[model samples]
Target: MANALSFTFIHVLCLLLHCSASSAQNVVFQPSFLTIHGPSMTALLYGFSSKITLNLQAIPSSNVTGSFVPPSCVPGVTQWILTSELIAKTAVQVKLRLNRSLRLCGNNETDTDCCVKPLCVLETLQLTACEGNTSQASLIIQVKIYALLGSGNMVFDNSTIIQNQVYRPLGDCPCDLTFNTCDLWCCCDKDCSTADFKLFRYRCLTGPFGGQFPDPEYQCSVQSTQNSPDWFPFLCVTSPPENNPYLGLFYQGNTMAPKPGISFGGSVSLAPALSNAYTEGSPILTIKDQYFTIPQTLNGHCVTNAPVAFLKNLDVRCVTSVQACPTEFPLQTIPEDLRAVVKNGIAVFVGNVVVDVTDQLATELNEFVTSSDIFGSSGLVCENVTLALDYNFHWKENGITGITLTRTVGSVTLKGNVSLTTRYSAMFLSGDIMSEPNSGNPGYQVGRPVIGGILNTSIGNDTVLIARSPMHLWKPVNSGICSSADVRPLLFGENSTSGCLIPVSRQNLTECSLLRNSVHSLQGALIEATLVARNGHPDALTLADWLNITYVTLNSSGVEDSNSSCADIPSHLHIYLWTLVSGFVDGIPQKDIKAVQISYSLSSWRLKCGGGDSAVCMDPAETQLLPITSSVTFIDIPLNTGPPKTRYQINFTEYDCNRNDVCWPELAFPITRFYTGESYSQALAKGLILVFFFIVASVLGNPWRQIRQIWNTI
Candidate 1:
């Protein structure tokens, strides 16, 4: 009877499986969503209706419904079960049921491995009725199922294997740039303890990389250890091996050749060919597809392939052989386009029309070379030649209207084979006014050359004119003696002291008057151009803009004594200047030259006599080394206003601690202690009481006896 009933139950299950497969649409199972682990096969199925119902006497409530429980279930350990008698049924109610251990990876083979997939098989579900407390009646049902996959990568997608891993949190300590040094007001620095942090109430939090602490992220990464969900291990990052893009049976046998990779060594791009006119930032071309290059210095060597930038002011000085002058020099040959524009009076256009200035500057090449032949009959001779090529381009709001080239060639033949210097400079000119850049828009910036001008009187114009130039100081060249050959400029906002030994010409017993006058004249020439005003605003200068020089005489009464020896001559010149700067903005201070005040003074020193006697000084004619020195001193005077504020203050104080040192300790150190609720004495008393109780308990417990017994056992 039992065997016959089993056969009948199997027959009924087969009929139900056929009916379910025929009734439903021909659904194809996605191999990527299917996985087999150990003895069972699981798949993440989709596309089933939410209202699908399965009628059963034992488990009537068991039907397809939307759920996230199955996806979160553990394979092998978590089981699904339902009872008819129990009012509260328990089972893994999920629409897409899958064994996470059984991944659909084709590479996985062994049971312990996660990369391989197991074989597929047919599964049947049996349902038995709760009859007279016995297994007399039962029913069996089988359903043909297929897995439905979505477009994007979900939990089972293979693309989720290789996720980018973040090593650390973003912007951990932005102010901590220099190692071992504690940045002012930086809270993240480990060197700054509670006591040091008390000095500054605020932290340096500015710019894109500034933050107090990193914010929380959703993905699993290094930050997950700080703050993350409980299931972080299951969602941990994975790195997969390189293989075909699409995996599974559906993508099998589709043999499409892989794409060829791009090569790193490709053809180089040539410079743009010259059109009608040149544009800004474009390479200045002489002819069509021919670039006009000048000798430029790279690593202290001259290179001829450097192209000129349009409308840019530059001056280059480099050494080169004299034989390469004809080819290396830029002014040797002029282009036809430039000549045509000059002859026809055509307005050259650089994206717009050009209007010519009234002043007609001549283009000339001045050569001051030696009369001797460059290539002598004996051998190839070289000299210390100086080649200066200047290009002045007149431009307005539209474009360049006029172009003028001036070349100055000077040569000095030395005893040996000395290289020549090739000096090239280009600037924009508008009539009599040349385009001079200012060190600062409203104030003078540091590291820029000091702007000075020689005051002059114009013929008809009432505006007081000044020949603009930078302030130069005497520096020794050739030998170790000061001369007019080499002089460097003084940088603005820089305080420097420089001196050199000058040879004085002594014919007969001359008084100190001649030496005094000579030294004063040389020092005076350096400061003659003294209008320290903004560019294009020389005439409208105030009292603060004028800088004057005061000569200090030999005597205490400020009077010169010509009858004294050469020691009475002036030897040093000191310059004093002040700049008005505004207050701090966003912790960074900005400087400007709104009001300038400058003054200079000359001083004299006694000279040492030879042989401890005045015999050498009294001689009729003798050579002496006169020391000449100059110094610059810069003083900053803060203004009432300052730059824009970058951040708000965390806590206001009584005085500015950053600038003023006379502030009280209370205001400077606002943070009294780490914890504000308790006093020092109270905390000490609590610690003492706790220690006393701990000692008393230890004595009564007699832990030493237990320690001895444990030691003996060991």
Candidate 2:
């Protein structure tokens, strides 16, 4: 009876499977909701056939409907419970394959391996329950999925310029670009037009990789397409060549004195300090004049505002006799001490750096560290490392102390306009890192440049003097200085050479504070030109990509331009000024700039034709200035010059600032307040009317009484 019932149940389940196919639409394995953290998960390298397997399992839920549960004869028929329960009832897990791996990155190597390692990035799953196999009563759906961040394709140029990193093409990184052409979201001009393109071909997120310039700007589509979801509200940050950027400890260079003084045989005195420099803490050392607290500690970052690398201070003390130590010492800044070189026996220090290579180091411990032929372990490469770091050092005695780091907290990433990796591991610091001096070991006195490294095991009592490389950081040069808020039409007059607006002179820019303030105010305005019919044309050089193109540097500040004709004046003044007027409308509660209407007046001119005193006249005083709207740029430019054209005299007029024989219409706008003395005839007429009224009153004899009697008789 049991065998027959089992066969009947199997047959019945098979029949039900055929009758009830899934009614829901084909579901995407990955959904739109996860793109926030999706970039990190989906970073895909092109040409690698990476695949991940997905397994779906159902959980029991009471709210689910549309059951496909089999009869009691089946052994395990619990999975086919519902259809409406999309997320609450079903769960999906992805198994990472081949080269694809998950990284739990953190502050140091030790923590990275243990920080937050999720078993799998959870995905919301929806499954069709109708097609449960007969024997496997508990439904288990397995599907083969491609390994990618999205359908968006990525291109890899095998040029070795960007080294020691992987490039996982992510469509959505961080939005740091403001230029339309550079805007990844814009579909119109981004040149990422998806017109009949195949499955593997994606458009450029930005213009040509190296730079963008000289032609039509990036065509950013206002609306997103089927594949390219409009990801916006991001900054236009410059893109780095490598992906999953991280920094490793390069070298702990040297410890600066607390102040500009050092210890001699037994006494401490003052010394010369570098100008425009500040002090951070120093590392522990075993110099004769120095002694340290049992556990000297300091914490700081590689770059000024970088992530902090808390250092449990190395304990360096002196057993040598006759060394009295001072309580406190001053410190020196990072860049100030990084360039010191070691020649004979004097110890010179380099800049300090702290990185969180925890996960990467932990995953490939042996692979990450190689046996060092020199002092410290080797193998980690610093091919294209870019860093900006700042840290603090704590000290007790002169020997050495603890360290603290500070910067924007995230991962220690190597990126952008200020990154340069050097082959030199490190240079010798001020004093040897050795715990005790070896009289015979010459290696302690002088050694080759040493890059920072992580030992798989802890360094014993011996101090490994890690060498510091020359850290190179770069700041973008100002091509042109533009003060947009104060931009106005050039005032061309007897004091000017060109009959247009006069640019602030180079001498005034250097000496005058007012000009500098004005220039600084108008920061990022675009320069445009009005149509003119000048037969003599200017130079035709383009300035779209100022970095790539040969630019004629103006004698003025940073605003570099292509126009050779306007070379004499400041390039910044040559650009347009966008005024920023910050105000509020009455009765409106203003929070953001959007919540209120800001009214701003620009320099305007209407030919004032001679007119009568009428309310309909277009008067300048009564005119209402325009209100701020959609444009983020808000400005209030001043109107200094009197008019576009002003008449010197009557019909015989002089054109002071008129262009192309065009004279503006004059206005009798100022209405005359007082009336001129009345004519003699008008005064006589008023006098006669007064006499006639008096004569009529005399004839009526008591006019008031006679008028009252006449009204009574009537």
Q: Which candidate leads in TM-score?
A: 1
Off by over 4 Å in 2: 1-52, 55-384, 387-572, 576-714
TM-score of each: 0.41, 0.15
Give one digit per residue, the lDDT tens place, for model 1 in 1-714: 665566556554644553344235322112222222122222211222323222222111122331111111111222223221110011111122223332334333455433231222124333222222322122332322222112113343233221222322333565676688776767677667778778875655553234343222333444455565444444444433211122221223233443331111122222222134444555654423455555676776767668766655666666544443343234243332223122111222112111121222222212222223446444332332235656676655434555565545333443234345456776866665676655644445677777776566663465555556667666543333565334667778888877677664334115566666777676666665555554222333343444443334445335554333444455666766566655445664556444344334445543346567564455535445667777787776656556754444324434445555776554413234433567866766766776686665554444755777789999
Residue 437, candidate 2: how far off, in angstroms?
A: 59
C-alpha lDDT score of every prediction, in listed order:
0.44, 0.25
The residue ranges of model 1 lying beyond 4 angstroms of the native Cα positions read: 1-215, 218-380, 383-386, 409-414, 417-422, 453-469, 480-483, 499-501, 534-564, 583-588, 593-622, 638-714
Scored by lDDT, the top model is 1
TM-score of 1: 0.41
